[model samples]
Target: MKRMSLASLAVAGGILAAQAAAETAAADDIFACYKTAPAAEPDWTAIARDYGHKRLKQGCGQQWPVAATPHPQRASAAAAALAVKTTPRPAPVSDFIWFVRKDFADVDMFGKPQSNEKATGAELSWARNNTAADTIWQVNGLVGLAYSYLNEDYSRFIGASLASYVKVDKEAHSAAASDDSRDAITVGGSAEVGFINPIGGADYVRGSWLETRDGILNRTTGQAKLEWMPMYLRVNRQIPGTFVTTNFRPDLKVQYDERQGGVVPIGFSGFGRSLRIGPEATFLFRVADFGTTLPAWAEPLAGLSGAVTYHWWREVYSGQSGSWLDSTIKYDINPNVALAFSYQKGRNEETAKRTDLYKLSLNFKTCAAFAGFSGGRCTADKD
Candidate 1:
């Protein structure tokens, strides 16, 4: 028993001496917890790897708590976990992009029972936007043909047009307390030029360049409009947990019209160009995200507008003023597909005469690549 006690004493002295020497050498540099449990050590390299900093080494050769290259081999379970997580988070990127949307419309009219007054058309809209911001530019083109029998005469009408719109968004801040509501003010302008052969009365009054006779007689028209949204607000719908949103905006528009036609009955008959200006007050209500709250969520929207137009010409039809009304509805089937319908009634160049037009349209393959739109691929690019 005495011999065993002396042996234990010598072992204890050797351990104590070794520990004291090691501590004296590593007193200021090493972690005390790691000295006791080196196998379960934690540091910045390990932490950074947890969030996907793969190329970083385990020890950057700095002082304690050093941020450096990640050496996954030193970690027990960390290395195994990282080996399984091969995919890396995408870096944020932002830039300008181009988009195309396909659309079809069946257009007809009220107060005209003839099938010639009804037609279906397809249109394509191309768009370009600054994905880093809320501004966009879009151009639309459409072509359609119509044939109908009237007075034993078969007349065919064909038309084509190109229209462009540009929007500059000055306010892009969301006002929702939940950090997702969208509130914006957009200022924009639109211009369209069109040509048609052997048109009807409705097409003629709508400022299309077309003659009423049978063969391919040509008529041309050009128009421009300004769009402004002074204020807008959006909120959760009546339900608390749904992704549906209700929004309201006050919209303003000013339009100018020029049509190539014959001379007026009274004064200034020197030219074939006619001019008119109209200012409108409009409002919009929109609800979106019925299925998912993803970006570019399909939305259903509606709008109404009223305006007083002033038309100027030489004699009989000069200094004419009248009221105009327009309404529209849109329903998106998915992020990439949708349908739209609109009705409009406006004053004519003839005294107190009015013309009404109806249109139904289908839209597909829609893409608006920006952070603000659904289905958009935008990454934050920091310089």
Candidate 2:
């Protein structure tokens, strides 16, 4: 963590830039006209233009070190030297941002799928890359509230998380998940190593692990994943650089109850353990760009993603195998709002924990992203 400097505090208070400009003005008041060359060939118009200098005195007042090049252009030697001393740049837009989102799904919200689930989420985040020390880092804090009712199976969960990501080196997307706070109240973190390429889109195998416990569940769980994008595969003739990403994820879900350890279909017991391993493959292609327009209730399908994962499960309650073929179509409704449709087919214990469900859900998002990653169309960078 970097300590807060006085200049930073002034900047936060919206006074640093004004103060610097005042200082520069004071310095320019002392410019020497005697050392300046006449207003002949070496006019020094570029320096005066950029520095808001309309008169020769402003250019002469430039607080730059005089160069020893005893040549014809002595008029702008000081200006030339001072140009290297650039004024502090304005902070990037929304180094810290706050956003709110609401989602409605026909099926369960990752819980049970028969009933509709209504959820709302909010987040405050900050990301800085190529910092004063030329470093990459991101921090985010978010909370989500969800509710669903299925024949007295009324469920309500508030999941809050805080995490920080930092780049360890200058490799492509080499940032690591340095700190993690999982599911409201987990006093732990995760470590990950990854590498990515602009053209290949992260083709290296990277591993990561995290363990978390919260008061809502009163239990602990550990999750790990190793992801790799082998290469691109042409799904159709026109699609370019279609990526094929593969990964394996392992999960350990355990709870404790006084009664005999046996798993039920719907929920977890006090002292029960379930272990699952999942292998997944996904194909994705970017079909469109930003500012895409769509009709009423229709979204511009910007990117296409389809994934299949098979889960092998072993538990005290039931030992079985389940799988899901999920497909998601991303759409850019506008710069502020985006819509998506996702379908999943799985009865894995690690997921819905119900019988197989033919589920489809639509997500609406209104957001602005200031930093690096390009997750959706509602981005501030416009790149």
How does residue 56 of candidate 1 score in lDDT?
Answer: 25
How much RMSD separates candidate 1 from the native structure?
25.3
RMSD of each: 25.3, 20.3
Candidate 1, residues 22-71, lDDT tens digits: the string is 33243332222222233345553333332231222222232443122223
- The window of 10 residues in a row where model 2 has the poorest summed lDDT is 108-117
Clashing pairs in 2: 108-113, 255-270, 255-271, 256-270, 256-271, 257-270, 257-271
Model 2, residue 311: distance off in Å is 5.8
**TM values, all candidates:** 0.30, 0.32
Error of 2 at 110 (Å): 20
Residue 162, candidate 1: C-alpha displacement in angstroms: 16
Q: Any runs in candidate 2 off by more than 4 Å, and if so which?
A: 1-190, 195-237, 240-271, 289-319, 348-352, 358-362, 366-383
Minimal lDDT window, size 10, model 1:
109-118
